[model samples]
Target: MLTTVRLSIIVMVLSISGDLFSQIRNNYFSASHPYFNYMGRVDSSQREYVRFDWPGVRVRFRFTGKELKLYFKGGQRNYFDLIVDEKRMGVFYASGDTVVEIEGIKGKGPHSVQFIKRTEGEMGEARFYGAAFYPEGKLLPWIGNSTRRIEFIGNSITCGYGSEALGRDEKFDPRTENVLKSYASIVANAFQADYHVVAHSGLGVVRNYGDNQPVSVNLATMPQRYSRILDMDDSSTWDFSSWCPGAVVINLGTNDFSTKPHPDKAIFQRKYEELILKVRNVYGSVPVFCLVGPMIDEPCFSYVKEMVENFKLVYNDSNVYFIGIPTELLNDKDDLGADWHPSYIGHQKIANFILPVMSNILKWNY
Candidate 1:
């Protein structure tokens, strides 16, 4: 009788353990490592559609619990695929949740997890605000798996407008709100890196909004937004120690060239010099890629490139490099997005050119 009772107790304990294991499985999307970004945008009560300040290119997701569902409704013909830990999970079409069997390590816990999503062509840009992980019981895991950190500096284009819906007037697709699908955002995804943006609409190194003020020849030429200088002065502005990136990409010449009557050539050069010095000081020993112009026309492109190269030579810093997008890339008839932003397909091309250079800088094989 004693032996039989002992056996029954053992059987009960095993059964309970199995049930608990299954429950845990349903609650998480476990893997070796997991990481994701928050989709930045807020919705309004009356407008059904939310206003997105940035484009909805692609968002990263990391989960330790069970499943993930990407809810979207921008395109009907669009297709996508998810890659986790360099393994192809499967291909999925637009507007659906593609499930995968998350293979997690057995005993020592997961080492890391990654979710890479890609879209092709110009069906419609996605607007992503945040991610929803199943079994919402535990806090999302943060495994420092980022291979590179990128900072994009540009204008409204960099802000990620028209990547989603048009504005109120019909100049573009007013139906959709701005999503997080900007070209820079997409490029960051292709490389699986952390990215930050320091761009605004109609901003220049010497002037702001619309070049309302004349360019200054001395320290006065620096725009208020150029406060990155102050940040560098005090470490509190940015702790490069914590996020010392391997490479930095600057895409600013566009706004500078767009300013009318052209900024005083001399002032522009001086401001660019100061900007480069500040960047060099903060990110010591890191490569800085300065882009000339995307759709920036004629003499302006040559002017900016000349300044960039001359500055590099002056500082004797081999870390500085320059590239030009040329008119060929902007051959697409619709260069003017909602308020002159790049569209979904436009962003993909931008990503193609910029990603390669960035990869080379970071020594990424892709």
Candidate 2:
């Protein structure tokens, strides 16, 4: 009789446990759902998936658990970073179909997670399926995102190509690039602001990075695709009405200066001014700053200065400003990212110089 009673007790406990575990399985929310908050060029469609291809784009959501698993698919090999409860855990490389399981989280009641795509569109697209929580956990209510918004528009530097390398000569890999540490990201994070990075590698306003190449065609330039979705498929336009940024940072022209067969000064300046006008039209008097970078040479910096001055004249706009960061800071042996790009340290050097200027402009404390 005691043996039978013991068996019955075990069976009843398991039945109750099974019902509790089922709650976690039933609580998953798709990426297309509103529970997921996206930044940058992530597109949600009726097809039940969210596709993101740009570097520095991010997806964030909340869950109640000590373990979380990310379900995702990518058009090609891709790398993404995870930040749980405001701390960066690590990067995940997803090549085939799989679940990125993050276990043993340090929290108790609830946790916040942000999946950040580190590679640019050159690698291919990444589609987020959804996320799963641990046993008996569920989703949290959505309060709005953190702070003011800033949009960064530029090229390889902004994409943070080769920024994760510790050594100077290490070859570039998609897995070694991290946009989360780029200068754009660093400054935005300092301000506790949401940022959008619209960038592509080896692309510029007038031409791509190549030696003695032909002049770029109409649609080949980065500016042509700036208004598009995921920086691809021109037919799918990015509605500017979707989100408004308090400031827009322009970081182009490095590729144009570094690449051979560059355009004449008059032509480059005209194109730059035209792009600025188009930006103003879309953003409507939003503060625009030309972030002359810690990459290109003095001549390029001169060009950026002239372009910003010229545009401000056209609109008589005081909101337009020039932020010049000398490229010489990266000349030190320890400063190079990889293939001479800015590493996390190099990005920090630039951020330290520029962030203070931005804080002054916005009248911010930090």
Residue 282, candidate 1: Cα error in Å is 0.8
Q: For residues 197-244, what per-residue lDDT tens digits would candidate 2 score against the true structure? A: 988888887877874653577446888888888776666778888888
Clash count list over all predictions? 25, 0
Q: Could you give candidate 1's per-residue lDDT for residues 58-97 as a string of tens digits?
A: 3345444343433333333333334444454543343322
Which stretches in model 1 have alpha-carbon errors above 4 Å? 1-136, 165-179, 216-223, 226-236, 332-336
Quote the positional error of residue 326 for candidate 2 in Å: 1.8
Best-performing candidate as measured by TM-score: 2
Give the poorly placed runs of model 2, Cα more than 4 Å off.
1-25, 106-108
Index of the highest-lDDT prediction: 2
Q: Considering only N, C-alpha and C atoms within 3 Å, which residue pairs clash in candidate 2?
A: none
What's the CA RMSD for each of the models? 13.4, 7.9
> For model 1, what is the C-alpha lDDT against the true structure?
0.49
lDDT of 2 at 105: 70
